[model samples]
Target: MTYALVRPARLDLNSYARATGLHPEAVRRLVALGLLEPVRDARGELCFSPAQVAVAARIQRLHHGLSINYAAIGLVIDLLDRIEELEADLRRLSERH
Candidate 1:
């Protein structure tokens, strides 16, 4: 079987911010806080995957809904991701029986 590798389109900081409906500075702050992961382009500019738009929205919802600081947001995101992974593992284990 031949598998094709698909690369996602990358967006510059401004585009990412616009897509996420956030200010560029807010996106930068998220990058600084390690909430968003971006790649450096050939010109040393930050680029984000289009998929991150959803993540940014989730972050905004969590921040505003819970009224939590960015640091706490990071922790919450981590826990949510861990729970997702555990749930997937549980599903796989059950499927094996």
Candidate 2:
């Protein structure tokens, strides 16, 4: 059988902003706030994964839906992430029993 190599999608800052419908400056602000994590290329430019688009959308929802401030959004996102991790761990533990 022949194996196929698959590469994950990566988008630069501007593309990421366009995909998320946010301005590039806003994307940079998110990065500065640690709301989005991006990898740097050889040119030291921020590059985002496709998954981050979902994250940016989530951030928007939380901000607009709940009227949360950007600073507080960081805490909210961290808590949500932790809850997901805990749920995953619980599922794993339950599966063993």
Q: Which one wins on TM-score?
A: 1
| Worst 10 contiguous positions by lDDT, candidate 1 | 1-10
Taking the tens digit of each residue's C-alpha lDDT, what string does model 2 give over 1-97? 9675986679999999999999999999999999999999889999999999999999999999999999899999999999999999999999999
TM-score of each: 0.86, 0.83
* Candidate 2 stretches greater than 4 Å from native: 1-8, 94-97
After TM-score superposition, what is the CA distance of residue 50 in candidate 2 from its true location, in Å? 0.8
lDDT of 1: 0.92
Please count the clashing residue pairs in each candidate, in the order shown. Answer: 0, 0
lDDT string, candidate 1, 1-97, tens digits:
8675976699999899889999999999999999999999999999998788889988999999999898789999999999999999999999999
Q: How many angstroms is residue 57 displaced in model 1 relative to the true structure, after the best TM-score fit?
A: 1.1
Predictions in order: lDDT: 0.92, 0.95
